[model samples]
Target chain A: MSVDLDLIHRYRRSTLTRDELVKVELELQRSPAWRSALNDTVDAHRLGATWAAVEGSLDAPTPSRLERAATRLGAPQHLTRIMGATPNLRRAWMVSAVVLLLFGLAVSNGERETATIALFLSIAPLVPVFGVGLVYGPGADPAHEMATVTPMGGLRLVVLRTLMALLTSLVVVGIAAVLVEERSILIAAWLLPAVALSAATLAVSSFVPIRNAAAGVAAGWLTLVVIWARIADDGVAAFRLPGQLVAAVALAVSVAVIAARRDAFSRAVSTT
Target chain B: MRTEADDRALLARVSRGDRAAFDELYRAHAGWLTARLERRCGDPDLVDLAVQDTFVAVWKSAKKFRSQGDVGAWLWGIAIRRLIDQMRKRRPTPVEANVLFDQVASAEDELFVGGLHGELGESLRSLDPDLARVLVATAVDGLTTREAGQLLGIPQGTVKTRLLRARREARDELARLEGDSR
Candidate 1:
């Protein structure tokens, strides 16, 4: 007998008449395949429906409750220490401070030429690259296994560390830009490259080792800068409109890649 | 049918610590899980605990959820495993077979086994309890074989073998009843 998918659908929805229901039941009794199909349809429909009886028990732990649980269980201390001892943020700050100090000395000594400022800005985005690369990866994180087993594993962890690195680098570099004596356009030129290169590094790191990905990104970016400098007759020409446009497109593509491969970050791969 | 894309999107949001998405997922499947588990164990508290743990596990493992699979089947698999865990922990007093039979027969009397009286029910009652449990979980409860295995704390291959045996025995019993009637 040919099974009517529409009949099974209507029967599951309880839209069948008494006679229709009997007919369906007879068909179920006659054909095991039909019975199986009906069972699947019913199960699928019921599985999606809300059970009012258990609704009261489904509340997730709230922030206050989570805090209380953590305190009672002595879990907060470990998490607090981990957050406090983040080596990435510490190294990021140190690198940023040193870079800013060198730029400050150079500016104060009457050496704030366009080429020098552009060169410094080009290299500034690498601070976050190194910072994020240091924090991520199995080798970098002593608590990598523990963190991966937690609910906040995978993309969430990647986003958090990357955001911290990006923000730290941006703040330090933004301050350094303010100190530069160049035009505002030159001062803002580093922003796009910083975002694009950092995002691209993260996207690449999802598949490759974080350290290798960071190195490749840095090398490719610096090579582009040097080549542009030689070809454009101006050493600072890589920070121009065409470069900024390329950075914007690269940033968009990198973000897409990161989203598509977000789960890869959760895998236990060692960084070289 | 809820689209796979919709469930995948919800799971993606859930992985990101989205409370609203988690709540939506809970609302969607909690009741069905509770009902199926309640039927198995006959203890509301045990069923509730299992349902809660299932959602919690789902929240923690949302990142591992495969987008290509059926979300309901996946959620059902988790719920059954949680139910089994709860069963192992407390071992709720087993309802006697006759009493459980009466309860199920009365509840689903007209809906599932209509017109046949107790033929299907009796066939179910006569099978080995383990095989019967697997059969009910899959055929009656509407869970897939994989899900039934997860719920029963057995391997998928075992679920398949037991299910095939259970179906053969049930069909034989029904045929015998038909022969006797004729």
Candidate 2:
């Protein structure tokens, strides 16, 4: 079976119209052998063959696997576009509402123990802001149809959201810090770590699928807040960790997460 | 085996002994899978392995598929697990090599034998690392122009223009090398 290399090249160069592309694709697909060859090349690429290797391998290849694989890997989705566009606003809203409630409750209780309940309450606003960042974070899988063929760089989006989240968190945390006005090493330690954790959460969440990460993050944040609330009320400084341990983990994790963001974003863009 | 009740229906048949149905399901979803896996594993090879592993796992555990739920969602969950597993495996074992591989290789070695020596090597040596990177990503990596653009944060058209220029240069260089050899 012969493929029109000239046609393919022209199409790649954007000289072909949509109708012509469809026609070319149809023509190529019509020749079962050519279709099989194309499928094998794509498959080989998937299996870790660089194009040069695939080109080399094509000279003496078996044909059977390609036939079966081609049919197995070509079905198109109808709703992919629609689903990709609509953000999961409902989930975002739910998370925001819950966080706001937690923040309000912590502030209104007026309970002063050895651990400052109001102090912990001050950090609560960071939750929803961080949640937005996490959901739209460096590599988040927005549950929209635009997940497919998104022309924008995921890393660019991540950087934008991360800056927004950090800026928002810093401002709100600053307000909380001022309102309390009783600065201590303990509060300093808690605030910095918490802010960093918020960034870490965004990075980590991007490594997984979007909905799963969102649900997991929501649950995890709630649990942390509840635990903090309990500890704060009991006058226990449960937020504190050994300074060295915290520093080491933070440094190492920050590096790994930054590296993984590229990988995660690439994966999201490819599969979406 | 795949009598299109829904994607869910195809998945159910895949749970059965229906290879054809499974093939149908895979065909329907592989593009999306490729896109997602591409994000995690920048190397296309690793992406394919992760995807294949995902389908293989799905085939083995079809009985575990929950019929009342979203099939694509379940498959995607499995895909993420498979991808992470590959990542865990690919994580550098932290070898003690202070010098990278290229630094250790000698120019006189058989590795640079034949016409690949001299100008081709010199030309490559002369390229800026960023230009070399762009060239490798587009020419060698098989990423679409759009993907290459996104990765490099350039416009798709710019990626195309750059790639065309790179290819032309490579072609001219190769031709010159052959002419000189003759």
Local distance difference test, each candidate: 0.66, 0.49
lDDT tens digits by residue: candidate 1, A130-232: 7676666666677777776777677776677677678867887777677666666677788888889989998998889887888899899989898888898
Model 2: DockQ against the native?
0.02
Summarize candidate 2's per-residue lDDT along A1-272 as a digit string, tens digits.
36656545543333443233333333432343333333333343344333233234333334344233433565222222222222345256445645564565466445553335444543443454445544552345454234333554465544444454455555555555454434565545445555545555556556665444445554564566567657665333434555325534754785577676765764653332
Candidate 2: regions farther than 4 A off = A1-102, A105-108, A118-130, A133-151, A181-183, A214-236, A241-248, A269-272, B1-182
Q: Pick the candidate with the highest DockQ.
A: 1
- Kindly list the per-residue Cα lDDT of model 2 for residues B145-166, writing each as its tens digit: 7655544445778777776666
CA lDDT, candidate 1, residue B140:
50
Error of 2 at A242 (Å): 2.0
List the candidates' TM-scores in order: 0.40, 0.31
Candidate 1 yields a Cα-based lDDT of 0.66
